[model samples]
Target: MMIIKEPKELQQELKRRRFEAAKQGRELTVGLVPTMGYLHEGHASLIRKARANDVVVLSIFVNPIQFGPNEDLDRYPRDAARDLALAEKECVDIVFMPEVQHMYPQPTKTKIQVEGLTSSLCGASRPGHFDGVTTVVAKLFHITKPDFAYFGMKDAQQVAVLSQMVADLNMDVQLVPCPIVRESDGMALSSRNVYLNEEQRSQALVLSASLKEAYELVQEQKSTTAAELKKLLTERIEAKPLAEIDYVEVLTFPELEPISEQTRLSDYEGDIIAALAVKFGSTRLIDNMLFQKKDVALHV
Candidate 1:
């Protein structure tokens, strides 16, 4: 595996081989797994998914533009050395760990919006967060031009938005969605897990617990109604002292147009994604679960 610090260095390195490969009439199948630096088991899960296919290229750049002024950018957990060591262990082909300046030059103006999908949930809280995410991911897609891209379902909205942009704009890469990785305690693993205090940490369980409650309720065929499910999860999380519910929305997968009411199995079509974002003290964490209606679809 190679560590590329500069964008030009990465582009320069890719150019030589891309040309050579293009000349031979061979289409290179590459997979890109994008992440912020603080590598955890959840991140490893993404790497494992990418490595299972063709050449896996991971980009580790903790985007500042994505962070709100009040959000934790400076305090955000990052260890490139730690991340690189972990990536090497996973046999990642190339680790594109670029600096901030290398990613975005002075006073960036333009942003990418996938429309409709990003305005709710995490977007409701972190305004322009998805724009930054989409912009960067789109840039990455253009830079690497991978055959497919991998992202954890933990950031369901971002995935949906990016997927939409790709579909709408007809981008050439396939979006490979992966399942959410969790800790034994049911907390969905995130890089921000490091910020949790002893007390705040315990309160964070309410987020997943509420989701679990929804899952269990729906599984029992008791209350699959969206309002009932949303309310059920919302009240439980609000009961926690440290937790503040940013948005407990249940939506249709791929499109993310908040489905406030889901009853019959037919109503919740294709893959269903349940996503939630909560704040513990000043830090925010997001997690989601992907429910497939085909094989593992819940029924009594």
Candidate 2:
């Protein structure tokens, strides 16, 4: 796999590939998987999906802009050699690992914000977090210019914000949302999982378990009220001694508007996402599940 550090070099390579494919009388499909460096099975799942394209580029830049002042920026995580090995194993064609300076040689003034979508959930807690995410992702899309970009459903809000940005701005890339990859015990795999101690790790199961309970409530019991669902989730996490609730929200998909108490589950068509962020010690983790009324009714 080729390791590209400079933006210009990466752009030049992509242009060359495009030209070569055009010369062969065929169109090239490039898939991009943007990440913040600590490679895991979740990232590998994205890589595997990207492998379907003729050219796959995996970016491993730990974006400083996306992190807040009090957030784990300096100590997020990094293992370049390990990440490169994983990229190679996943058959990735190019790994773009750019330095902060390389990405922002001289940042003056430019921020991409997805407005309403960023106003709630993790956005409410983190503040300017989604703005940083959208800005860097927009930069990456412009530099990589891939035909398709892949993201995990584990970050349901991130996916929602970026998807809106793509549509609103008329970006050329197709955003591909992949399923969440979780551990056997149901904790959604995250790079930050390394920060969890043995005890904290065990307690962390509450995040997923709470979502599972919410799913059962809606799918099995046909419980349609958002208030009851959020209440159940909040209580489930608060019961875990190590877990501290950050946010428990049930909202409509894509739109991401709050599910009103008046809105019945059976009456709402399309997808609904139950997302939450909780802290097990100082390590903050997030997870979400997507539900469709038809699928829920069928199980009932």
Candidate 3:
């Protein structure tokens, strides 16, 4: 496995590989698994999915642009030795680890924004966050030239936003969203989970618990309105003293259109996501469960 830091060199190397593969009368399908390091089972799941492609290119850059001023940019987490070892273990052909200077080089003059979709959920709380995500992912798409890019559904909003960006811009790469990898106890895996203290770590299970409750509620047809479900999720999370609510919302999937507080779940013909973001002490975590509406019944 090759660990490439320079952008031009990586791009040229990919070009050469493509030419060589074509000359040998072989079709090469590159799969990209983009990540901000501190590898975990969640990231490993994405890498495993990418293994289906002819070539897997894992890009490990802690993107500076996506972070807000108050965010954990400096102390996000980094262990290059471990990340490289995991990349090799995953059988990734190329690992792109670019520095901020290599990715930015100079001040970024342009930004990519998907309107309407960015108006709610995590986007509402973290302003300009998706813009940075789209910009960087676009650059990776250009550099890797992957036929498919794997992303975990743990970041459902990110999956939706990036999918829109790909379609709107007519990008050739196909996005493959894998399932959310959870701990046996049910907390969604995140690099930031490392920051959680003992008590905070236990309290973090409320996130997955709330989502599971929401899922059961929807499946049983006990909760009908968006407001009813959101209230249940809020109350469940608030029960844990350490849990602080960020946003609890039930919105249409992909479009991310908000469901009216009094609107019946059956009134929505398509799928909807029950998503919440909460802070456990200084660490903030997000979780969601998607439900598909069928007649008066909703299935998870």
Candidate 4:
């Protein structure tokens, strides 16, 4: 596996590989898995999906642009040696570990922002967050030029926003959303999980529990009202002494538009995602579940 630190060098090498494959009458399918430096099972799952392609490039850059001023940018996480070992285990073709200077040699004058989709959820809480996300992703897509970009469903909002950006910009890349990797006890795998102490870690289960409760309520009780679902989720998280609710939102999937309190579950005809962000001590975590009423008519 090649460990490339320079953006230009990696771009040139990928271009050469594509040209060579074309000359040999071989169709090359390249896949890219973009991630921050802390590699975990969730990231590994993305790599596994990318393995189906002819070449897989995993980027391990902790993008500063995507982080807010007060966010964990400085102390996010990093272990190049460990990440490389994990990528090697997955048989990744390339590991792009570009420096911040290499990724943005000068002050970035331009930014990519997806409107409407960024108006709520993580976007509402973290201003300019999606702009940073879309900008860096756009740069990565241009540099790697992969046939498909793999992203985990854990960051559902990020996936949705990027999908819109790709479609609007007519970028020649397909975004593949993988399922969320979780622990046996139902905690969603996150790089920040390392920061959680034993107590805080246990408390983090509330996020998953709330999601499960929401799923069950929709499935068993036929609970479909957004307000009632949010109230139930809030109550579940609030019951846990250590868990603090950041936001519990029930919105339409992909569109991400808020559902009115008057909207009934039976009236809604498509997938609805119940997403929540909670804080345990200083560490914040997010989890979500997507479900729809069985009796609701499918909308094509």
Candidate 5:
């Protein structure tokens, strides 16, 4: 219910709330849901999960550091009023929406880099992007001091990288990865979805469509190789003239290492993530499905 702007103020307020709860002989647990200013069902799902904790703190800062030089930092969609209303609807206890200057009083010299995870997927295409991501999220973890932090699995690579950072640094927070919330038609939810025109929006479904088909093929034991899976995804998305392929990667989940081209789905012993990033008329949309190998077959 409270919207905090200053970092110190948020820390003080959380401390005060913890103190009050302690006096009542109740231990306080804080949950943090970090996001940019646009609120969608995907973000709402994260807040709902955070609500399990005693206090749900949502930070809606569109981190400038995360955006590359040519990326859409300037054009990133934002609706503070709508976001705040949604937060209120979700019963969020605190909304930490800080300005760019407040977050970075001066240019930051410190950067947290998790090496291998940063070399592929979105990181492969956008250099220094994950550095920005890790740096900003680290700042948020320090500022909010939450016992648990919630992130959507749509950005699975991010979950992997941040998890590494947390473990490596001994940070005292549990990273909760939630499922990808999608439209009825299967298009993954994203704030950038606003940039899609009618035509592009319709064609964008190919991303999810391809992923769904890929998931089925893996599940049904179609006897396909990793290379074949990538090709199938590529061909399907390429069928949509408007869809431009950024990367269609079939990599090991969390590890994100490349599976050999000849490696069949059945032979793979761990979790696999088939991720796609495609651009449709200046708007880039990403969708992926995790294939977990339980026994002879893979389950999504």
Candidate 6:
């Protein structure tokens, strides 16, 4: 994989990638996967599939504008050399690791906003997080103008928000959402996995287990209300000594508006999504599952 560090050099590389493909009279499908510097298996899975099907353009930019006042921008782990090494193994054709200043100019003010869905899930706790994410991803998309962009399903609400943003903005790219990569235990894999101490690691299972219970509740045909299910999740998540429940709520999919009424699968086109956010130690984690009313009705 070629590492393009300079902005002008990267643009020249992109033009070369475009011209080389055009010479063969073949449509070059470039799949763009955006990430912060530190890379992991979860990110590799996205790139692997992108490489199998298209020219993979992986970007590593630890965006600062996205970080809030008290957030972990200063402390977020970063290792560019390690990230580039992994990108090569993943069959990524081009890795664009831009400096923080290259990604943002002084006196920049514009931002990208995804309505409704961003207001809930992790959005509720981290103010302006999605705005930063959407804006940076938007800038990358414009610069590379890839045929497809990929993301992991572990960030369920982010997938929903980006899907909405692309449709709304009429951007000419397919946003591919891949499944989440999990630990042998049920905990979802994340960059923040580094923060968990031995005890905190064991306690973190409660978050996933609580979501499991919520699904079980829906399975038992117990009166399935979003509120009671969320309550069950909150209680289980907070059982850990250092864990704190940020928000655990059942939301209707796509719109992601919090569900208040008794929602039936038939009513929602089989697109209801359960999402939650929790803080363990100083790290915040989010996870969700997409389900249909049919899945609830068929519970064994």
What are the models' TM-scores? 0.91, 0.96, 0.95, 0.95, 0.97, 0.91
**Candidate 1 residue runs with Cα over 4 Å from true position:** 19-26, 260-267, 295-300
Model 6 poorest ten-residue lDDT run: 291-300
Worst 10 residues of 4 by lDDT: 291-300
Candidate 3 local lDDT, 169-214, one digit each (tens): 9999999988888888888889999999999999889888878877
**Candidate 2 weakest ten by summed lDDT:** 291-300
lDDT of 4 by residue, 105-221 (tens): 998999998999998989988899999999999999989999999998889999999999999999999999888888889989999999899999988898888788777676666
Q: Model 6 TM-score?
A: 0.91
Instruction: Give the higher-lDDT candidate: 1 or 3.
Output: 3
For every candidate, C-alpha RMSD to the true structure in Å: 2.6, 2.0, 2.2, 2.9, 1.8, 2.7
Best-matching candidate per lDDT: 5
- Pitting candidate 1 against candidate 4, the one with the higher TM-score is 4
Clashes of each: 0, 0, 0, 0, 1, 0
Task: Please identify which of the two predictions, 2 or 5, would achieve the higher lDDT against the true structure.
Answer: 5
lDDT of each residue in 112-156, candidate 2, tens digit only? 988899999989999989999999999999899999999988888
The alpha-carbon deviation from the true structure for residue 125 of candidate 5, after best TM-score superposition, in angstroms, is 0.9
State the C-alpha lDDT per candidate.
0.79, 0.89, 0.89, 0.88, 0.91, 0.79
Give model 2's TM-score versus the native structure.
0.96
Candidate 2 regions with alpha-carbon error over 4 angstroms = 294-300
Off by over 4 Å in 3: 293-300
| Candidate 5: tens digits of C-alpha lDDT, residues 184-284 | 89888899999999999999999888888898887687588999899999999999999899999999988999999999987888888899999998888
